[model samples]
Target chain A: MSTAYGVAAVVLVVLASALIGGFGIRLSRTTSDFYVASRTVSPLWNASAIGGEYLSAASFLGVAGLILVHGADMLWLPVGWTGGYLVLLVLVSAPLRRSGAYTLPDFAEARLESMLVRRTAGVLVVLIGWLYLMPQFQSAGLVLRAITGAPEGVGGLLVAAVVAVNVLSGGMRSITFVQAFQYWLKLTALAVPLVFLLLAWRADGTPGPGAGAATWALPLAGGREYGLYSTYSLILATFLGTMGLPHVLVRFYTNPDGRAARRTTLAVLALLGAFYLMPAVYGTLGRIYLPGLRGGDMVVLTLPARLVGGVAGDLLTALVTAGAFAAFLSTSSGLTVSVAGVIGQDILRGGVRSFQAAAVVAVVVPLGLASLTRPLPVADVVGLAFAVAASSFCPLLVLGIWWRRLTSAGATAGLLTGGGLACGAVLLTLVGGPHTGLAGALLAQPAAWSVPVAFVVMIVVSLLTPGRIPPGVARIMVRLHTPETLDLDRGDWRPRSS
Target chain B: MATRHDDASVYERIEADDRFRELRRRFRSWVFPMTAAFLAWYLLYVALSGWARDLMAVKVLGNVNVALVLGLLQFVSTFLIAWAYSRYAARRLDPLAGEIRAEAEHEAERERA
Candidate 1:
């Protein structure tokens, strides 16, 4: 009986996404429309799409489950995740949009004025996309195993198929509307039960923070030394890393102006903040309810069932399942769009034919990797992606925009230094058992080290190769400075001919 | 961020525009050192946690190990750097951008002849 509901929920979510994509296909006309919705998406719609993709299975389920297991320390994951956007808003959103790059590679090329730098940036974007997508695929399999008692491979395969179809058919244009709608759908499906659960918890004698919950009350273990270090590292990575993310950075270009870019980021922050709070609540409650379960990690799926077992339990589980499916699909589609864009532009011609083929290559490679291997904890896997991003593209984006002295040689050096180190750490993680705290965290979460390494490498290399800095830097700056109405490529990007 | 000068010139147009020179002077004022200091704080955490594992004892809170303090600091530092970067950008970088923008506009108007 529960299996039937789970099956029904999955079908509904897939149908919903397809329905949205089908409608989007009718509206998709130009390549710009396909890639960035002609840079005219409203903030509200864009906000919804951002929320949809941002609230991955990790956000919807893993963070909460982690909180249930680890206490307040885990809270930092959601806090840092949401705060990453706030950083994006304050530092990058508008200027990046003004830069007129579709992918991170575009930003790197224009910023550093070198194809080598652009290619380096392009490769790193794929690595980050692939690293990030692996977890989504893993979780999809995990969720399937939990719901249908099916093998782990089934859900990952199913999701890849669904995500590939949607992305290939509609591109970014259709994916935008579909993801926007999924964000709300996921929120409502999760939120409604949460209110009921809070009431139910209150009625069930309103238990205290639970038995082992006392340890969570202590903020830092000792003085603020460790706290200071960890927080700063995470901050540096998230704040710097946002502009380099092909998926997130691509969104900024959709806005029409700097002001619109700023406003869209603000809306995203609010939407993300609201959604983030819900997961922590689920995590906190999971502790009180499902403490004895194996893999305290899967508690998000277990909570609704434990709280309202029987028909209601089945229904709530189905709703959560559907939301989880939405998370996987939305994020995967966004990643596919970004990765395919990079593959098409850098490696292939980005023709319609190439775009379609690139989409398949982009999705297939990661799905194979995910099927062959089990990833680390969801948070850890995601953090590694951030670390690689920090090392490679983060330096390029930050220095490219702000520092005038940066050369393409510098960018290439930084990308290799940061991305190479990060990839090495990821390999260590795959091969080795857990290291110590900072080492484990660094290995597990290498962003803090990789970002600085990248930055330092860029600065050092640029100093040595000062002569290679591009001659057109001034003119490019003028173009970047020009307002959208005066943009030379406004009509060009929106070319009517295929 | 440089101009295109003729080939006979020995140097590229690395001239620091008035605002930029000022911006550079001001950037080194507090921020460069400050970011370096914060960067140090982060590295210390990694060093202490990984290499100096014996430097501190492990305590338990709920199920979170004591090392979480270091982990959480990573998040806190992210906010601090973000705030710091934004503050620096608004104070130093924006003025330079505005001045350059105004100068560009003025130059364009003069060129209408």
Candidate 2:
């Protein structure tokens, strides 16, 4: 691809993001606006924003890359990513919105009424957010270097600066608009070139995936060790992980009520279902057209030029580059806001200034880590984050909402056992080098063990610590499960008509 | 009915209310079954791909196989579950929850008076 086109595309995306971000704040006011956009976003807009933020570089680049390398088995990555929202829709969405909490820690405090539980949750939220953000920053470098041939660090630095600026200036209110727009932009950017790419394929009588050794089409093919267990672990993490992401949960808080949250999630299911379909196309086509590519991440970037070949091809590649950057920017901004929100609430005094300071800290810490860490496959790193979230927050959200017997001690114990173990596994996987046997698989994908352990520990501790149940459990349960139309003085209420 | 500031009693009243019970029952009726079924479906897909590669690899159409169709069905099931859940909530759950809310509000107002 031409350097000029690539650079131009990156510049335009950044400028557009900045413009929307800078102006988005003028339309925002009040603490509610900063936190949850005053809980006034409609289902369509909220859904779009969710789709925008949720579909990170993993969805944009990593899925195709994985599919190119591993073939059919990797399809589950996108399946789980989108289906994770379905889990969110049915289980967590409405009640979480009804809780009227600004962040995950607030929800914990509101539900458990224990400062210890709340503080524990606050820590996990920051850890998960930072873990998730590191990959986005690293992938931005990959995209930038792939396109413009710039130094790898340039992309991460550029994204960190842009995201910090966006969050510090306007927080969630500014981001909602920017993310919603980026969703459509990303869809068009990937989808438009796709039509041409398909046309090119058809014109050339599109070959099959390189006369595949039949196993390529098989789901758990290529003699993957512990393939069955690994698949189950991946399923466990992603299926349960969606509800636990700090950024995803905060979006539900932007809905006016539980009903709207349900609606927004439904819309998200549709939008994401559509958006996810396009990547498999790129992945499959890359296999057929650009076989034996060195880096699967670059498959999406290079496929268009390889298949189409001309100024037109260069333009399409540039479009995909722009889309990839949007993926990084929108996802990084959302994570930064959620992480910064937690930091601002727990670490610093609450307010816009604290949030601004936290935003810098949020992005910069991850940016520094991205620089220091050896680059893992972007999708693998993201999966590790999901595993940690599933083992930790999934248990918390599920048990917290439904079970009144849950005590603060139980919740804290569960988070530590679940989240702590998952994080330990992630660290081992990152630093210990790849292992070759059962030990390797367990460490590589810990959700299968860790999530169950968390749940069991929580239940057992809650049973033993029965006396420690928060006295406010009934009222909190009523508030969370009850319809908002109820007129009871749900104490500490805020007017929603802002 | 309970005093305005007595949140525990108010919650107790709401908890005891027939409509609130009905709301909880109806919401749980769908959500629990739907969640269980989706998880079952997803796990089955994972299990099949994990343990039964031949079945997954069996060709159904030209260049398309069972795995591909099942993969697509994952998305289909997600959309279906989401759409079905939304409709169910709108039709059955919301109205019941609303009724309970209205009663709670009425009780609060009477207590205030």
Candidate 3:
């Protein structure tokens, strides 16, 4: 009965997200509307949509598990993830809004004055999108395995189909609404049980951290030097990584102006920070209450039942199951939008057909990967995604925005140098064979070194060859700087060569 | 020196619809340097953590650990930087951009004429 209820709840959220998107298809008429929602999303709506997608499988399932295993130190995952946006808001949000870019590749090519840079960026965007999406797909399998005891493939297929249905039917216009709705659904689902559990705790005189929980909290991992290295590297990846995330950066483009973009980012910080806090509470609670339980990732799902213990426990569990599924559906849909967009533009011949085809690839490729690889712990998989973002796109965005001297050769050099190695390390980490201390460190925490090498390669290469800067630099600058409501509000997405 | 005529010509060009022109110029000033600033900030972060070993230990919130605090500040700094960009653009750069945009449009129209 519990499994059936959970599966049913999962189906409901997926259908709902898809249905919302399908409805948007009705309003989506123009190509622009299809791609950028006609640039009409309100700040609140856009923020919620961003949040819906941002709180991926990691936020829903993994944070608590990480806390269950690692203690307060794991709080960094949610904190860093939420905090990354603050970095994005400051570094790239407003200027990015000014840049009038349809995508990350557009920003890079125009900024660096090189088509090569754009292509490299295009490739990185797809890679980062895939790396990030893999976890969401894996989480789906994990969720189904927990609930239905079904083969992993069944859940991955189910989520992929649901995502494809929503994305192809509406493009971004529809997906935006679906994501916004899912954000609230995820929050409510997580929040309700938290309230009940807290009440239960109060009635039981507020329990203290247990032995297993206390150990998880203490940062005691034998070797101090290596532990320090691990801590710092993880920080580097998550902190700098947010600026380059395609979905997050894409939201700034929807805002009316640079100021509005910043405001939207602020809204997201508060929203995400609030949502993140609840998971820590679950994790802290899990440490005391559910010690020695395997599959810590299930901590979020298992908490209510462990605390309350009865018919009410079953009810709360069902609610959390629904929310976890919402997290999977919401994030998968968000990733689908970016992956589908890239494929449509770069690979497909006709735009709309390409979009539909791309949507299928977006879901299918990751689903296949999820089936083959036993998913890593949710937060850990998300961490790998961050390392890639930090090494590849972060350098590109930072340099592209402010460095007039950023040449295509430099970008290509850095991207290949930094991105190639990081890609190898990530694959090694995901492969799950021969995990040694140093190998584990390199595979798990490559960003600290990788990000710099990427940046240096771009700069040095650009300097070695003094070449023509893009003629469009000045004109593009004007578009990016001008506020939409200002007298220069051309609102045109075209890049002009001056 | 043909000062009067040169000054008059310059004044005439300025008086024409080039209000947004300044926006791009101001943007160029900020955008170029800001990129450098981020690179510096990123390097500063890596260097402080990797090479300057003892620095992050200069602590803040108890068990909140200074290293972790500084690391978290990196994220905070990103938000502040983005916010600063918006304010600078909205107040100074955007206006200049509008002037340039108008000048471009007007010039394009004149060429057609």
Candidate 4:
């Protein structure tokens, strides 16, 4: 495959994003637009944008790579990823949108009525956002190096610069369109090449994935220590973690009301389900065609060139490359905006200027970390972020939204314990040598243990400190659980509305 | 016009309101069961993948195993659940929640005046 096609595709995607960001600049003249796009995004467009941003490097490349390497068990990754939205649609979307909180911390402060809990949420949001963003940058580097033979750090730096610019210039209002466009772009990139790849496979007598020892054909084939425990833990993390992602939750706020939020989430489930099917095709084909390929993440990129050959293969590779870069840009921009919003609102000043400055900080910190760290497989790093989010914010959200007795003190304690434990496990997995035994499996997949512990601690603490329940709890609960068409006194506050 | 006493009274009224209770009951009935069922279904998939590998590997069609069909069904089930929720909410949950909200706001407005 020629380098020109790959580089040109990358350049075109960057330019298109920048152009869209500029248009968003004009549309975003008000504080409301910057925060929630004036809360006017329709369900279809919001769903597309959510699809655009949510289908990150992990979905685009990591799932294929995992399936290529791990066989049928890796199918669970995409399943869990899309299924997370189903969980979100059923549990969090309507109530969360009705809560009228712009960010996770806002939801925290409103529900628990405690500044301490709010600040704890803010810190966790930044930590999870950064942890999630690092992989996007690292995968950007990986994709760029694969396509153009550029130094790995260049891709991360390039993507970081583009994302910072996009977030700083447009914020959420601008990103909505950019991400929506990206969803379609990514779909075409992966899906179109897939048709040709399938035809090629059919022509080659429809060989199976090269006689994988029967275990590879089966689930949980890898005889890793505590395999069942790890699978269940991963299921817990991905299923519960979607509601807790700062970026994902922020998108729900863009919907006009709780109904629209629910509709948007429903749309997102469909969009993601359709897009996710294509990666499995690539992964399955990669296994049959390119069995010896190392670094499973590259399967999507390399398979086209191997099967199709010549200019057509190069063109498809470029298309996939463009799609991959768009995945990085869209997801990074979403994460950067969410992280910067929390940072700017809580730590810095409280306006667009502060947000712009914080956006730069948000991207730069992760960009540096991506460069410094040994690049883990993109999906593994993302799974670690999911575990941390599941342990921390999942507990906060589930309990705060449903249980009326939850106190600020209890929320803070739960966040610290669950979040701190998960973060420690992630750091251990990263810095400590490869885990070999029970300790390793536990650290490697902390959500199974950490999430339940967080829930118990929260419930017990809230039960003990019954008097600490906020006086405003009933009012907040009414606001959360009600529909928007209601003329209720759900606090007419629109947070520094323009 | 928005005072501390007014806010407190509004919440007190809502807490006592039968509409609020009924609304909560209806939404909870749907959301809670759906959530539990979905989680159980997901756990079953993961568990089968881990503990019941042979069951998952049973060939369902030409070249497609039970795992592949089940994996595809994960998407199908997600869509079906989402579609079901949309219908249920539109039909049952939303209208009731809206009525409670409207009544609460009406009372709050009366108090403010």
Sort by lDDT, best first: what order? 4, 2, 3, 1
Model 2 agreement with the true structure over A1-498: per-residue lDDT tens digits: 798999999999999998988877787666566777877889899999999999999999898888887788888888898889888887877777677676778888888888898899989999999899998999999889888788999999999999888887787888998999899989998999999999999999867776763677777776356777888898889989988899998898788777788888888888988988888889889888777887688888898899888999999999999999999999999999889888887888877777778889999888988998887778888999999999989999999999999999999999999999999999888776456688888988899999999999999999999999999787888888877556555544332222
Q: What is the interface RMSD of each candidate, in Å?
A: 8.5, 2.8, 9.2, 2.3
Q: List the residue pairs that clash in candidate 4.
A: A65-A296
lDDT of each: 0.72, 0.86, 0.73, 0.86
What are the TM-scores, per candidate, against the unseen true structure?
Answer: 0.82, 0.96, 0.84, 0.96
- The sequence of per-residue lDDT tens digits that candidate 3 reaches over residues A214-270 is 234444332222655666677678878887777777766666655566667767776
At residue B1, give the lDDT of candidate 1.
Answer: 19
Off by over 4 Å in 2: A489-498, B1-4
DockQ, every prediction: 0.08, 0.65, 0.14, 0.62
Question: Which lDDT tens digits does candidate 1 get at residues A44-158?
Answer: 8888898888778778877887677666556656666766675466545545666666777777777766888878888888988998888898998888888899999889889
Model 4 stretches with alpha carbons more than 4 Å out: A492-498, B1-4, B101-113
DockQ-based class of model 4: medium
Chain A superposition TM-score, candidate 1: 0.94
Docking model 1 quality class: incorrect
What does candidate 4's lDDT look like per residue over A319-395, in tens digits?
99999999999999899989998888888867888878888899889888888788777998899999999999898
- CA lDDT, candidate 2, residue A349: 82
**Which candidate leads the pack in DockQ?**
2
For each of the candidates, what fraction of the native contacts does it recover? 0.01, 0.83, 0.13, 0.72
Cα DockQ of the candidate 2 complex: 0.65
